[model samples]
Target chain A: MSEMLWGIVFLLIALLVGFFITSPLLIIISPLVEWSALMPYTNRSKMTWLIFFLSVLYLLIFIGLVSLFQSNFNGMFSKELALIFLSIIVVEFIAVRTTQKSLYQLYEQNKWPQE
Target chain B: MNKDLVKIILVTAGAVLFNLVFWNEKLAINTVLFDAFLLCALFFLYPNARKSAAVNWLLLGHLVSLSMVVIHNTDLSKIAFVITLLLVAGFAEYIHRSAWFASGSMLMNVVMIVASFAESFKINKSKPANRKGIGRFIRFAIFPLILVIIFFLIYRGANNAFSDIANRIGAQLEIFFSHFFDFFSWQRLVFLLLGLLITGSILLKSKLDYFSTRETRMNDGLQRSRKPMRQKRNGAFFSFVEMIMGKMASGMMALKNENTTGIISLVLLNVLLLIVNGIDVDFLWLHFQYKPGLPVYIMVHEGTELLIVSIVLAMAILLFFFKGNLNFYKRNKWLKYGAYAWILQNAMLVSSVFLRDYYYILKHGLAYKRIGVLFFLLMVLIGLVTVFLKIWSRKTNYFLFRVNAWAGIVVLVLATTIHWDEFIAGYNLKRRNTVELDVPFLLSLSDKALPLLDTNIVALQKRENDTRVINVNDGQPACDTCFIEQLKQREKQFEQRQKEYTWLSWNYADAYTKQYFRKRGLITSIH
Candidate 1:
């Protein structure tokens, strides 16, 4: 049981370090959020919705892990935890791609106004 | 402007905070504040003047200057003297720029002489006059002092953490003099020093208007000498070479503009060159491997010969085939593919020396210390590859080249994986043979542990054991005989395991090291 707990802790630490390393990418991308606002209402709202969905996805992963800990079924919980973590990674990747595409679309649609 | 100031402050604060977090470094907050105050004073003093860029450039330049000062292993007084000479030279340049030509030039020359002397003696000194103006003094001193304090604090913290990390990590860094001294070979050292001198001279000359004026004079002369007879005689050859060179130059410029493709090509070229250099040596061959009177590998070896031959052949081939094919490569898809291959081949050959040295380092521990030579060779290889690619590809667009470069990486990675087991096995075997061992236990132990031994200990033990036959008083048995006997036994066991599992020898050795270290209490726990 202790070994399992330690493993969980190690996984969490690794996740945290990974997040820290990836933070620079997020910082670089954060400026695009302002540019996203200039898009047509539908496109803007779509991106907002996507971001909201991503947030929800992250929350769900956290909730699933917490629930797993609360329920004392180790084998099932471990398997589910792994699946949840993998899903989180997939979702993050998808979110980044979507954000990038939305940014490109916005740029394409909004050419500079002629003098 | 206030926003810009705030941004700068925020960036500075963030930088400080990052250092504090990662390195537990303390910022000399008072010193920084003082510097900021002084900078504000300077801004106020030069309110109407267009000096912002100058100030910013000076500050940026000082970062390099101060770093050179701090990192250089010289006495404080000597450092101060050198700094004084540099300041004098900089002031002289400032004077020259302000149009005091002859006097400024003389002063600058004087400063240079003084600076050179200081350099020869390796002496640099800080200026007492810099402390005269309260704001100017603080502006100069405070920032550097803060940087120093922060650096020291970070260094202390990092050292402690690094020591702890090293202790936790089973592999410890040991410096072997043989590897270390090999880097300082006279030829390489002389070349490096010469290169530095040449670069310094070039920079100094560029700063003078002498070259510009001479170039202008040459251009004027060329324009004046454009007679019809001369034009008729030289027109064909001149036009041909000019067209080729012009296209090449423009292509390079275009490639530079297309950053992604150009960079990828450059990187690919470098990687290819590295691979070629790495394979230059007949690593598997016996005569080259076991040569007496200083390993041929240390000095110039078969690898060098192969490298020269490959480069010459590549150049000849490229010149012959692609002499007038630039336009074709640019327009035709098939030709472009061929061009890409040529680029890859060139890059591989150029980067081979670096890759080979890197492989040696990875094979041998940090104890094999010819890092200087390795770095020098790598630098030279990179420089040559860059120049070659620039000339050949004409600075091709990064976007156009990036995909191909990435494909090359994928292929290389695949090749690496294919050879991964052999490399690991070889490395482990070398490592194991190097270390001291209890001959009986070593002979009995699994073949997997043999490669992990330090060569120094093994060699020493080998010597001791060899002498023991003549003097029975020596307790230890012959290491080479025992090692061979043990290896034979382990080889049979390994062969059996190999039949059961593909590449079991490599995997077993890796696992054995982990287990050995774990048992030795080097590792706290395995992940």
Candidate 2:
């Protein structure tokens, strides 16, 4: 497949996974992770395993949130929802930066395209 | 799990902990706990943050400010709380590139963090496929929905059969969704989104170059500009004079002109302030009198504000003169001496303001504004000292700001540690014989002062009987019985409220107040 096609496909897969689990972090991170695949330096097999690992991690977060909502929320009528959303944002930012940094490192190790 | 993943999970867990601590409660011990959790999360997530002296100091300041909320929690403490949070966010972002920042960078860091968050959320137009697709879908969806609604209305009007079917379907849909509507809270969803935005602003490091670039360019040294006089500049608005004087002598001439202007201005200002300060010393310091029937405003009203303006203007004028090449001029010694004299006079002016507030508090008893005046005067004194330092050390204006800003923060944090309400109550009570105690004013104090008021009930009653003591709330004579009843009612309400507080909402002030009431038999022990 062409790199452009691969990019779109990865993006679709990311959106699909994010939609399924309702994790904004994965929605943001997955496509970028896939984009890393196009880099000459990225090990394809390692990227695959990373994606799988991330999916499991996203699933755990999904489950944790759902259970917390069930136990702590009775239809989400108050400020606790706000606090939960705040935490989600903090998590999303950390995840994005970490993923981006790791990808840059991978590319740099293999003679980054920009250089 | 990797450290990043652990950080993510820990942050989320901290949010849950935050929710549990603050759900349906006021800020108190819960804020302290959440702050500690956040600091720990930051430390673990950003190991480099530990190396930054500014970050470490801010962390300590944050802990102290949060603890003040549990101890006293006045408006000053709350303001300190918010300032500390901004400082934390600023320093956290700054440590991404370097571990050090100027003291003035506190404000800039806060501003940049906000700007960076805005930058991060900015949608990339280059990534057109995703945005365009989403935009097209929303546009198509909205257009069709509107057309459908309009046509449905037209059809309903034209055909009774269709109208009946549509109405029946709508009713059934509403009935089915009423249960869902009952459970769904739009407020909660909106608050959740708001929380997300705020949290992202603090935690996310922005890619903005505005603040960092400016910070990198900033230097504390007062460097002499080597720009040739031939190049026209804004400061050379008097270039025609330079032309007439000749370029070789122009730089020296301009420096002499600035130096002469500064020296003359400072000298005149100092002499004028000397007269003012001398008068203040004589009236407010040496021979102060408590004149009965004199309004309190005469002593501390517009006068204090006007003097404060002058004091600030004094610093501004000195900064204007000493701002540039004047500091490096060979003949600038006399000018510097004059500047020093003006600063000394301003310090004396600040002392006079302090004395004025002292006399006002002595006359009218302590209030928020009176206490605020003291703090404001303290800041002015510090400002003057910093300005003096700036001139003496040949430092940049940035140095003045950096030193003064930190001084302001230190004063604010220190002020928050005191229980002002109790302090006011105690101070006013001690001077009941010398000053007219404002009974209604004391009654309006926070729960922290209740113990003090209760302890002095007999003395308060005696003052209430004196015709000189008036209920400022009304034109009527003060009644001790009415005052005592009001006090008892407040005690009851305080006890009931204290009982409702969980461990999360616990604070030393409330706890001690409750304990005091319980021991006095005003509140029964809960089994």
Candidate 3:
């Protein structure tokens, strides 16, 4: 009974830590990147799909890491470590796209007349 | 006529009615005192209601009396009666808008009824006031009174029901208080305080504006007017937060709800497993020299596996919530399909466990071994399939992949049910042999020594045969030749033991046997 209780406590702690580390990135970066990628100058549809694919791949990687380390690691560190890696990757991806938003808008303006 | 006095009367009456109907002697007195205090507090808080005290008191008294009578008789059934009265009074007040006293009385009655009913139902449905001659008068005079009466009745009914049940089933109040304290041990309390701190920070960030005014009569009118203003003040943040919270909370709630149910069921299963394991362990420890079979170990293994599964499932739910608004499946059609496949696999795993348990119980007369193998297989299958699906969904987009995933789930469930009885029987035989060895000394005693000893043995043996043991040795254990041979062995042991000692001299042995049977929970003494 004690072991079971400890396991639940550990899992909750790990998840909470993961949420704290990820929430700021989700609030600031992800939406901004999605908004920028929809600019007319860029290939909006393709970019959207690319971003979506990358997110899925990142999630899958994290899922894999969690399963692989489930038995080897004890307590919060194992789960939190995997989630942090996933969150960082997402933040970097979103930052890259947002930097190019103005360029994409200019390109869309140039292409609109020809279309 | 002072409005403050009227409001006080209405509120007090509502409280009194609530207490009489719902509260037991102990709780009723407390409720009545609490109500009186609340009335005084409200009046002091808003003094403008002083003019209409008489009408307010009259309405309050009526509401209290009606509520007590209705609630004390039949709790929930009086809802219709209370609702009908509110409707009648509301219409009457609407017709007599010019008479402020009548209108105040009606409104007070309505508020009292609604408050009382709301407490009982835990819902907040209120009747709108009518503005249009006779309708206005009727509404003004009776509507408020009716509302007060309804609220009183509901509060009384709910309180009474909870108290009565608590009293009858032993003092649950004490148990609840103890459990509550235990639940909030220092560490848990600290966590709760931290959670509250976070909530406070969020609330502060939202910056809610509170209503503040000095005129008592105007304050009541102001509260009604401020409803729309309050909504406007927080509309954007409210909607945005609600949208985000709803999505996040729903996923978490679903997972939490499912896992909670699963954990409860799993705990019950574990307790059952523990009892069976303890009996077998005790038997093996006391009697047999050799180690028990794989089936015994298998049962323990299954219990551990189920516990692990429940934990994992619960964690999965927690993770889903913590992930925030990132719903991969909902955002992408392909991922949704993958999620559906994953759900199917999970359902299959749960069903397989149920089927396996059913099979084992049928074969083993509630012994542990019969159910162990099935649970072990289920756990392994679930772990393997989950990982496989996660990998496969990433690699393949073929329609056939989906088909195969679903097919695997169906096959897993079907196979468990098909061979359930045979599997159960194999385990039961192992358990029966363990029991016999454990209680060999008791079995050897003379018939006169333990008056019901022979009957107990026969009944146990019969149950073993009738239950899962028949499947052991391919049903050969119950065959005529095997049955006769087993009976002969028992008869020989009985005679040998009888010659060795008299009934009175075997008191120590008798006591030991009784203890063993009690521990096993198999000794039905009434027979």
Backbone clashes in model 2, listed as residue pairs: none
Q: Against the true structure, what is each candidate's TM-score? A: 0.26, 0.72, 0.19
lDDT of 3 by residue, A1-115 (tens): 3454555567679989988976765654455445434332224332443454455556565666666878443543333453475466667455445534463564465453423
| Model 3 agreement with the true structure over B1-527: per-residue lDDT tens digits | 45434443444454444433333222222333433443453344334443454425333543453343222212211332233233223223222211232334444433233222222222123432321243355446566976675554445455777547646655665566546545545334334434332222211111011111111122111011223434634767445645655544234354344334434444554455456445544643344233346444344446446645653663354233222222322333333334344444444444444544553354334433434545455654554454444333432212223334334333333332222322233333346644432223333333322323433455555554555564675634344233324444654564455455433223332344344434544333222
lDDT of 1 by residue, B450-488 (tens): 344322234535654555767876665444445444444
Candidate 3 achieves a global lDDT of 0.40
CA lDDT of every candidate: 0.40, 0.67, 0.40
Q: Please provide, for model 2 over B210-246, each residue's C-alpha lDDT reduced to its tens digit, 9 standing for 90 to 100.
A: 4566667656667777666556444564464456556
Model 3 quality (TM-score): 0.19
Going through the candidates in order, what is chain B's TM-score?
Answer: 0.29, 0.84, 0.21
RMSD of each: 29.8, 12.5, 30.1
Q: Taking the true A–B contacts (Cα pairs closer than 8 Å), what share appears in each candidate?
A: 0.00, 0.00, 0.00
DockQ values for all predictions?
Answer: 0.01, 0.02, 0.01
